[model samples]
Each structure stands twice: as structure tokens, then as C-alpha cells.
Target: MTSSVFITGATSGFGEACARRFAREGWSLIISGRREDRLQALAKELSSQTEVLPIVLDVRDRAAVTRAVDNLPAKFDKLTALINNAGLALGADPAQNCDLDDWDTMVDTNIKGLMYCTRLLLPRLIAQGRGASILNLGSVAGQWPYPGSHVYGATKAFVEQFSLSLRCDLQGTGVRVSNIEPGLCESEFSLVRFGGDQARYDKTYAGAEALQPEDIAETIWWMINQPAHININSLEIMPVSQAWAGFSVHRKE
Candidate 1:
């Protein structure tokens, strides 16, 4: 049977890259995103490589997510992998200065959205058996604290904990669960975080030699292809130029 992978946020960034990567392997693709035009364009482009099902969906919408998953076609019903990649970080402001709406968006997308997909798809994945996997797109912000991380980081922290805990609950099941924490990636993600400030986006990656969507895609590819007996609990990736900031000290005048 041909393997099928359902990827959320397939319009751009790591999600899009993963869709391309899996399609190249001839895996049936169920790609979902909020942008209908972009999703359709991607499906058209990848149709030549493999079977593609483009779903115009906002992961934050529970009813919509339910409809999409519940109504999967027979051909796409047996899923081999699920890449929960529909997430975003808005603003680079401290908690006190941050907008409450931004926090809510982050929670809805990064935390709740991921939860909905994972919960809804677990049965299919479990039925698919040993080689099935769940790959969550987490961030270094979840592991390390920074000035402007705030709610974005907290939501990712939820992802990390949820992945680990879910693994425990799924111990008997052969389905694998992994959370990938990435640092300093250059993609449209930065643009969204910066509120579509092109200058800020450009400046963020100007000379950082940051990780790209393809890099994360490659990591995910390796992870899902691992042997059924081997479960990679978690993986953290950072570009060479990126590292932990030692500490912050305040000097009062």
C-alpha cells in the first residue's frame, strides 16, 4: 500500500518543504492550509510527483479540522505519518508589552490546533501500525527563555510536554511520537511574527546563516523513516550561528 502523510500548514515554511520531500518519495499527500490558492497551487505542482489532496483549512478552527479529518477519502484514510506544523509566533514584544490577542492566537494555533489534529488522527495512525509517526514542530523558545518569547514560547512548551506525555500513553502502540525543536529558522514564519515587516524579516536573517525550511524537512524525513524499533523521543536543531545566550544581568544606575 502507498503511504500517506497528512501535513498541516502546507502553504509555506517547514510544512510545504515536508510535503515536497514526502511527495518526492511518492507518498500520497494530504496537505492542509488556510490559503486555498496556495494549497491548490501546491497540489497541482506536486500532482505530477504523487497523489495530492489539498485541504484549505485553518487548524485553529475545531469544527473545520473535524470535518476535514472525518471526511477523509478512502484512499487517504490510512495515514502513515502526521506532521502537525500549523503554528505561528506573533510579535517580539515582552509579555507586559505584548498584545493579548497575539497570545490567544498563539495558544489557539500552536497549542490547541496541534492538539486537535493529533487527537483526531491518532486512531488512523494507530491503525496504520508500527511505522506510523507523529512529528510536531516545536521551537527552541520552548526549551530556553528569551526576552520576547512570552506566550509563543509557552505554547511550544506545551507541545514538547504533550509529545513526551503522549508517547508514554502510547507505549503499547507502535506509533511513534517526536517533537522537533528548531532555532533561528528563516522563512515566512519570521514575516508573520514581525507582522509582515519585510525589512525586519530581512534583517533577522541577513547574516545569521539561519536554518531553512528544507533543513527542518530533511530532519523530519530522517525521523519518520527511522526503523520501527527505534523511536527518537525528541530532537533539537539549531544553526551554527545560533546558541544559548548565557545570561541577562541588569545594572541599576
Candidate 2:
């Protein structure tokens, strides 16, 4: 009973971790990422362990996304699960001082991109009927607001609320939708937060145990494997050291 799983943003972070986690379970993996080389390398590595097909795609480009899905070899077309994990925070900027480019990127990839893929896959998943899962990668910042999260938080908030509506729409269908809200994870998050500023990146995690990408991957796998009758609509996973968006400790002892 092997299932097929498709993941966006498989080059790094939670998506990558999920690829490894699912591959170990004998699930065939359809990994997608913007970086061709990274995707190829990961595909090669995972193929040795399990069935894997890597695709290079930029979720922001609607045409590219469509091609990526349509070009999937028949063997990988029947995806039992799809993880919408291609996202990032371009800059930690307040609304009044936000970078327009950053805002555009957030809107395009986090909001528009997720919607595009879901729209394209909805039919495929529904056609399969029975059992299919859509896991959306979200952030706790959407729940608890922060100072410099003007656009990032808004995008995640959209994902959070959208998943709710999607779950309601797929009521009778056996399709499951999960909004995975993560608090803190140490996987180039800060670097992305500071926009490649190495100095600023060095300071975000001075003394705190942040959740790792693998942690979220494990939780996602668990939610999918739960009893068939259960639908994990939402999951809020945060590190013990992270309290909320308002407060985060950065000093040890």
C-alpha cells in the first residue's frame, strides 16, 4: 500500500525533511523546488532509498507550476498527499517601512502560489476521491501578530483561514486539509528574515532551542498516518523555548 506524496520547496527546510520522512515509509515522493541542481541531487539521493521524482519549479510562476504538474509522469500523477511548503519571509519590515518587493514576493508565493497549486490539484485529488491530504505550511505569526510581520503574517493568515474554508468545502469528500502552524524553526528562517544579511542572521538565534525542520516533518507524517477516520484540521507546533510572537528568549542561563 504505497502512497504518492508531492511536496513543493523540497530543496530545503521542512519540505526536504518531509521527503526523507515519507521516503523511509516506502511512499513514492514527487519533490519540487526552484533549484534544479538541489532537486536533482535530492532526487538522486532519495531514489536510492525509495521511489523519487524531482521537479524544478517556481511556485510563483503560474505557467511553470501548471507545466510542472502536467508534466508529471503518470506513475507520479496520482498523488495521495500534497504539501504546500514553498514560502519565505523576504524582510522583517513594518508596514509603514516595508519593502514593496518583499510585499510582492510574499503575496505572490505565499498566497497566490498556494492558491494556484491547490486549484490545479483539486480536480486530480477529487478524482481520486476516497483519501487525499493537503498540508499547508503556515506560521504562528498569523495568529499572534508581531512588529515587523506586516505582509508575512498576512500571507500566513490567508493560508490559515483558507485551509479552514477548504476543509469545509471538502466536507463529504474524504479529502483532508491541514493548516500546519509552526512557531520557531531554525532552518535559514532568520536569514530569510534579514534578506541575506549574515550579520543580522547571526543574532536571531543567540540562545534558544528552535524547532527544526525535521520536527515539523515528523508531525506532518503523524497527522497523515492517523486513523483514517480522523482529520487533523490544524496543528500548532512550537518549540518549548518559544512562548509567542510577542516574546522570545534569546539568552541561556
Candidate 3:
């Protein structure tokens, strides 16, 4: 039987790249995103390579995720991998000045949405047994802290811890889990976080050879294709231009 994968947030960024990467290997894809036009366009583009099922979904909705999984076509009933890439950062405001709505949106999409998809799709992955895996898109913010990271960082921190704990629970089941924490990739993520400011987006990556979506997709490809017995628990990626910063110090005058 051919291998299949489910990828969320497939309209753009890592999710879209992952879809194309998997399609290269003839893996049947169930790609979901809130943008129907983009989803359908992707499905059409990949259908020539392999089977594609485009689901117009927002992972934040538990009911919608459940329905999508429960109604998977016969060919996609069993899955070899689940890519939980449907997440975002809403704002870069400091915690005290940030809007509560932004925090709630991040938690809902980054944390809760991921949870709903993972829980709903585990059984399908388990059914595939060995070689099956769950790949989550975490971020460096989760592991490190910055001035305006606030809630977005916290949500990714949850992703890292959750991925680790899941490995423990799934040890005997042959279903592996991996958390991928990336730092500063060039994508629409920054635009969203900056509320569609093109200047901010350009400045964020200008002169910085930031990692591309394809790079992360390639990393994910290597991860899920590893030997069944070898599980990659956690991996972090950062561009050459990126590195840790010294601790901040405040002096009172």
C-alpha cells in the first residue's frame, strides 16, 4: 500500500512545502487550511503527482477537525504521518501592552488546534503501526525568550513538552513523535505577526539568509523517513545569521 500523510495549514509556508515534498515521493496527501482557494489550487497542482484531498478547515475548530478525520476517504483512512503545522504568531507586542485577543488566538491556534488534530488523528497513525509519526512545528521562542514573545512563545513551549510526553506514551505502539523548533524562517509568518506590514517583513529577512520553508520541509522529510526503530525526539534549526543573544540587564539611574 502507498504511504499517506496529512498536513494542516497547507495554504502556505512549511505546510505547503511539506505537501510538495511528500508529493514528490507519491505520498497521498490530505491537506487542510482555512483558505479554500489555496487548498483547492494545491490539491489540483499535486493531484497529477499523487492522490490529494484538500480539506478547507481551521484546525482551531475541534468539531471541524473531527469531521474531517472521521470522513477521510477510503484511500486516506490510514496515514503514515501527521504534520501539525497549522499555527501562527499574532503580534510582537510586549505582554503588558499586548491585546488579550491576540494571546487567545495564539493559544487557540498554536496549542489547542494542534491538540485537537493530534488527538483526532492518532488512531489513524497507530493503525499504520511502525513507520508512522507525528511531526509538530515548534519554534526557538519556545525554548528561548525575547522581549515580545510572551504568549506565542509559551504556546510553542507547550508543543515541545507535549511532543516529549507523547513519545513516552507511544513508546510501545511504534508511533513516533518529533518536535521541530525553528528560529527565524522567511515566510508570511512575520507579516501576520506584524499585521501585514511589508516593511517589517522585509526588514525581518533583509540581508539575513534566513531558512526557507523548503529547508524545514526537507528536514521533516528526512525525519519521517528514518528507520522505524530510530525516533527523532526533538530537533532545532536556525540560520547562520541567527544565534543566541546575551542576557539583558537593566540599570536604574
Provide the lowest-lDDT 10-residue window in model 1: 70-79
For all predicted structures, in order, the TM-scores are 0.99, 0.93, 0.99
Instruction: Write the number of the candidate with greater lDDT, choosing between 1 and 2.
Output: 1
After superposition, candidate 2 runs with Cα above 4 Å error: 245-253
| Candidate 3: residue 137 lDDT (0-100) | 96
Off by over 4 Å in 1: none
TM-score of model 1 relative to the true fold? 0.99
Q: How high is the lDDT of residue 74 in model 1?
A: 75
In the predicted model 3, the residue pairs found to clash are none
Local distance difference test, candidate 3: 0.94
Please provide, for model 2 over 1-253, each residue's C-alpha lDDT reduced to its tens digit, 9 standing for 90 to 100: 5798889999999999999999998899889889899999999998987989888889999999898888877775556888999999977766888779888988999999999889888876775556788999999978888878888999999999999999899988788899999987888767877878887876676677888899999999998877666889888988888885347667988
**Residue runs of model 3 more than 4 Å from their true location after superposition:** none
| lDDT (tens digit, per residue) of candidate 1 on 45-148 | 99999999899999999999999999999766668999999999999987899899999999999999999999999999988889999999999999999999
lDDT of 3 at 42: 92
Q: Superposing all C-alpha atoms, what RMSD in Å does each candidate have to the true structure? A: 0.7, 4.0, 0.7
User: In model 3, what lDDT does residue 105 have?
Assistant: 92
